[model samples]
Target: MGNARTFILMAVMTALLMGLGAMAGGSQGAILALMVAGAGNIWAWWNSDKMVLRQQGAVELSRANAPDLFDLTAALAQRAGLPMPRLYLLETDQPNAFATGRDPQNAAVAVTRGLVAAMSRDELAGVIAHELAHIRHRDTLMMTVTATMAGAIAMLGNMMMFTGGRDNRGGALGGILAMILAPLAAGLVQMAISRAREYEADRLAAEITGQPQALASALARIAQMAGRTVNIPAEKNPASAAMFIINPLHALRMDALFSTHPPTEERINRLMAMRA
Candidate 1:
């Protein structure tokens, strides 16, 4: 059901792009914008893991340092039927984690120092399994495409203002519409894809580990602490904020408006329900 919703939402986004492009640029322009967006996302798909890791100041986790973490992650990956992705650690006080890479083969999971210190063995296991589910589901690629498309749609809306569109009247109208609607579309896109994917990951993680309560507990603790701590890298690169398990930049007012992830309280409620 989640996959179906995502597919329909993606189709809607593409159609919106084409329709908006036609109004502003012409049929050809819409196609070009989509092609460009696709190309850009393809590149992002290839290099996202490295770019994200570096942007967040993640370093490779050595087995020598966190042997238990390595073992737990390896076990979860096995259960998820995915390769043992490379592990990285971020030196932040915020209890958060994110998974990257286009597919299971190239994936990596980075956990913050705060997350390591905050969660217990079972809580950490639940968190790791959640990330492993993301890797297995190839959510990194799906989210990359959705985010890039949203930016492209927003950009196209702005483009109408400068280009006056191919037809002056049509361009004017398109520009007005894009300006009003582009951000709306972007918000919807993130909610439809990113938020749904998070729910799906939570469900799959529960299935993989058979311990929804642990993840629910981890989430509750993270939510309590995330607002208190500042994640500097997330603040700097706000667009990358959606990659984390929770909205790392929870304090940002704009995030409250656009909200990349689903509500933590609701997520916990669902997870807790699974235990009954």
Candidate 2:
């Protein structure tokens, strides 16, 4: 169901992009829009992981530098029947983690310094298992693609507004409407898809670790700390907020349209129910 929802939303977003293109420059514009979106998705698929890691200032952590973290992730990967993904450490006090890659074979998992300091061994396992679950389901790829498409739509809106709708019959009125609506619609779709996958990842992680309670506790603790601690990098790159296990931005109000992660209490309740 999550996969289906994501596919539908992505299709709708693409169609909207094409519609905007047609409005801006006619049939030829529509074709160009599709081509641009396709090319952007492909580029994001290959390089988004590296881009995200670089944006977050994540440093690769080796067995020599992080023996216990490496070994624990390896054990979790074994349990999940996945290859050992590369591990990274983010230098931040905010407790959070995320996984990124094009596929299982090339995946990477990153956690903050605060996460390592805050979570116990079991809680850490639960977090690692959750990230592994994302890799297992290929959520990382889907997420990156959605984000890229959404960003492209926003850029298209800006182009239409600045270009004065000169080439197509959309007119200044239509251009203004598209400029306001296109990115907003894309953001809603992106948030919906992110919420759906997050629930699925939570469920799969509980099953993988057989420790739903630990994850629940970890979620609770992370939520508490994240409220007070600042994640400067995430603040700087709010587009990447959905990738984190918890929402890292401090001031953004989390409503249906704005939130990437589901509510912490609800997520914890679901995990507790799984344990029960």
Q: Give the TM-scores of the predictions, in the order they appear.
A: 0.86, 0.93
Q: Candidate 2, residues 58-163: lDDT per residue as tens digits?
A: 9999999999999999999999999999999999999999999989999999999999999999999999999999999888887777778878887888888777
Candidate 2 — which residues are off by over 4 angstroms? 1-6, 167-173, 254-256
User: What ranges in model 1 sit over 4 Å off?
Assistant: 1-10, 161-164, 167-177, 251-257
Candidate 1 structure quality by residue, lDDT tens digits, 74-122:
9888988998999999999999999988888999999999999999999
In candidate 1, residue 35 scores what lDDT?
78
Report clash pairs, candidate 2: none
**Global Cα lDDT for candidate 2:** 0.88
Worst 10 residues of 1 by lDDT: 1-10
Q: Could you tell me which residue pairs clash in candidate 1?
A: none
